[model samples]
Target chain A: MINRPEPILMKGNEALAEGAIRAGCRFFAGYPITPQNEIPEYMARRMPEVGGVFVQAESEVAAINMVYGAAGAGVRAMTSSSSPGISLKQEGISYLAGAELPAVIANVVRGGPGLGGIQPAQSDYYQATRGGGHGDYRTPVLAPASVQEMYDFAGLAFDIADRYRNPVLILADGALGQMMEPVLLDATPREVLNVPKPWATTGMKDRAQNLINSIYLDPDELEQHNLNIQKKYRRIEQQEVRYEIILGDDADFFLVAYGTTARVCKDVALKARAKGMRVGLIRPITLWPFPSQVFDDLLEGKGNRQLKGSPKPFGFLTVEMSFGQMVDDVRLSVNGRAPVYFYGRTGGIVPSPREVLAEVEKIYAGGAGKPEKAGN
Target chain B: MTYEMLFAGFGGQGIMLMGTLLAYAGMIEGKKVSWIPSYGPEMRGGTANCSVVVSDEDVGCPIVTEPSVLVVMNEPSLQKFYNTVARPGNVFVNTSIIDPHHPALARLVGENGERKSQKEKGGGRAVMSENVSATEDESVIAGEGVRVFKIDANRIAQDLGNGRAANMVMLGTIREVTNVVEMASLESALQKAISKRHRDLMEINLKALHTGAEWVRSHDVPLLTPAG
Candidate 1:
């Protein structure tokens, strides 16, 4: 018989921290930020009990550098911050990526472009998926929509980081970071994946010293390193595309969203379906991979019977909490095959399901065959 | 069943705690629940609110835009959210701090679905003349089908000892009126929300809850089951 712990109500930040700890994360360093302070606070209280180290660094930059240092020594290290604080950690993130050190950085996003409000927003989609730092490097981004996903994805992020020897980011919004929900913790203990880091900078006794540096002074060597990094990113893109498709069998149109916005889109889909309009949702779990295959399949009329016989046209409505960021990727995937409409609310405003449904209805009322890009 | 509840009041009024307890109770009963507090920019002592959504199925959105039930523990919250309640819903007002006949509530209709003003109030209802007159059933129709529950929650808590448990009283009143969660589940949730260090305060809180429930029972308001 499998003994599982009962579900307990927990904030998303606390759950994510606990999930990381359970996955054998031992070192944490983070500066305080609104909507995500709970992560560091939880780590401060629980890390010592597990024989882990938690450091409240003086600044976001210092915290991320500390993570880089710890991860260099083969420790599963992590750091978290909000939007502005995350901006301060970009250089360190680039260093981690360039050095091929495994680490996790969580961003409980707030409004962007500057030191924006502390309210929830998805303005960081572009920054997260498209490498916020200055490099020819890409960090795999996991977007968790619910509190459960926030908990489950922490370990997954760490595992992905270690698997690729690259930094992995968990991109969440203020809402997902602050919300509380019940989560069932796995009671049975399991081994953390046995991935030995032979290249860790532990010691040089009886072995060649491991050099963990991103700067290659020779141009040829630098070019070769960049090529290897690009190859790894391509492999990750092929193998790590994650998304959820809901009610799309006969959907006449699809609403593409992620994170908290996707949850709202789910409700909008249900409401539209109840009114006899066939609506669906395509929620991208991996924002970096972007789940382009789902869009490709839908455009080919694979699942929906209506689109097959007569080539009935269908459109994609991309809803976000930012102004037309993810829509660009959706357009790239659609490749102008169908009209892609964009609807967004910015500056810390979370669009309501009613408002999003109105947008979907508007797109439905209009014929879905056009190939124009509708921007909002 | 899905219940979207919004609890709003001053920061120190335990508004967040009230919503958390409801969410916890719903989770204990094997329901999917989400609770989100408003962490926007605000000054100290400013109004605070939290939204809790409890559903038998998956919770689509944690933020409650149109609430099935709105609990206003102060005047500002009522002024802020009275109109946002869904039609055919319930709004619980703390009459100890909020005037039942305040100008902000002038547009709301009476319980019988008539637009009655303060001047149109008839004779011989158990009116709290010191404040606004308490209605016969202690409720007023706020919208076309929305019922407003007016209870002096502070006075009820004071009567039971410890006025700070007014939030608990309001919780019990809402529980009795809506039956959103079982009483046993609520008791367990209370234990979870409060810490073991302050376990001694549980007795008064339980008393406050019962007192609030008794107030609802003695007033004989209709059952306001949560909207789907």
Candidate 2:
């Protein structure tokens, strides 16, 4: 039996890189950018050591395209960047979604509308959750709050992506990327992965030529392809919604957040409880699936029935680092069963625990505004 | 309970290393721990700071804006972090370089004292500085209101043959004062956490740590109290 190694201190970016390697990621391509340079720098040194290929692409666009090429071969491949660079990779991501290829992408997000400060931010919430690139297709997104999550979810991302044949994104921030924590690598042994690629372009053999094409010229064919992709996504939604519920035993109000925002929300929950409030947290590990059913179940008094008859139990509050991007999803999940409120801090600024608690109080007092209906 | 600390200094002062060692010791003690370093632009020549959190329960927000303790190695670091420290929090200063009556602490006192409505009847205690003259003359009066402990970490590190070992020395002092970890466990953690390439330097670091701990114990400074 392989014993788990003792916990070692590691940065989030380094954990992501290690997770990729253990998840059978044999190909990596990336361009260096602030707050995310460590990912590429680490891969440059480590990939070769692990008998893998690491390429320093000229630009973010090129790096993502390289990821596209490697993913088409049905191999575990990845590329990473910050917000501005992620914007450059949007086209390639959309293409990967169109092609229905499996790959991993990491965005160690920084503050941004454009060329913003190099600090941790969740400003890309809308971009990641609503499909930043031009398409109706959605990629699986994983938001990790801690360095250990950075490692755990990175491996989970690869598996989920391959299982669905869809691109998976590790949505982190500068703080998560730069922070170091003791990570335990003992839960599961490194999975030995072999993605069979009969359709790969590793030079046509004696078998029938396999053509990997995203371009379906015929309108009917394109629609059929879209329908097929939708079917896969529907299957994923049915199977792969992951989240963590904290202190929900007697919770009357639920705080919905993800990534670094969730970490802060947890602290606020503690403070709220101390002040005689029944606040709990629902942290979605998977963003694309959105954990809608979990929210529905909780709101309908299915999960945590102890919270059922609380007199002052409010609805759910969606907290993020962006301006109400994830609030729409929270509203969609609740489907008007209970009030859905939003609180946010943008431009890479994180909300303090006091600010989050203040919002919770506002919602509890029936003062928070009703969530604007989404166009879905 | 959780103890959050910020170690601030110039880049070469091993502030980050000091935080890392504390975090390592916490890990050895089986507590949840996190160590976050300042990287990129602010780490070049400007003040560098790192936050370390150790808790029996799960750690919530690892980015500590108001730390329970501040370990400052330079005047700039002290200036940058003096105001953000929690009230009743300890501030460890390297008094060999920084003046006890630095302008930053004066500003902090002006703001905090006025805002908190502290009475001005008693003279405020200044941050303790090592009295070079007192070392020879032994007659100077030191104030007691503000808690401060003075140590010459550089001299100790130089005597240990590696100036960077000053970080470990500080770690030893923190361990002794805070009781976050025992000295033996910290030494073992240092041995395990450091890279194999630095194995040979372990003995020197061990010696420096003991020396620093002995310095703190021998000084009979009442300010070096345990973090309650």
RMSD of each: 3.8, 4.9
Listed for each candidate, the true contacts retained, as a fraction, are: 0.84, 0.66
lDDT for model 2: 0.78
> Which lDDT tens digits does candidate 1 get at residues A1-376?
1325898888999989988998889999999989899999999999999899999999999999999999999999999999999999999999999999999999999987788899899998888888899988899999999888888899999999999999999999999999999988778763577689999998788889899999999999999999999999999999998988787667778889999999999999999999888888889999998888777677775663423432333778889999888989999999988888888998888999999888777777774334354655
lDDT (Cα, tens digit) per residue for candidate 1, span B1-228 = 889999999999889999999999999999999999999865267779999998998999899989989999998898888778875677888989999766555443333223344335754553322123334654642334566788888988888888899999999989987889988899999988899998998999999888888877887454433332
Candidate 1 is scored at a TM of 0.93
Query: Candidate 2, which CAPRI tier?
Result: medium
lDDT of 2 by residue, B101-216 (tens): 45554343232223122323322332223211111111111222223445567767888898778776777776666677778778877787678998898888898889878776
DockQ of all predictions against the true structure, Cα-based:
0.81, 0.59
TM-score of 2: 0.88
Model 1 interface RMSD over true interface Cα atoms: 0.5
* Whole-structure CA lDDT of model 1: 0.86
What residue pairs clash in candidate 1, if any at all? Answer: B127-B134, B128-B134
TM-score for each of the candidates = 0.93, 0.88
Model 2: how far is A229 from its true place, Å?
0.7
lDDT (CA) for every model shown? 0.86, 0.78
Which ten contiguous residues of candidate 2 chain B have the minimum total lDDT? B132-141
Question: lDDT winner among the candidates?
Answer: 1
Instruction: Tell me the TM-score of chain B in each candidate.
Output: 0.85, 0.77
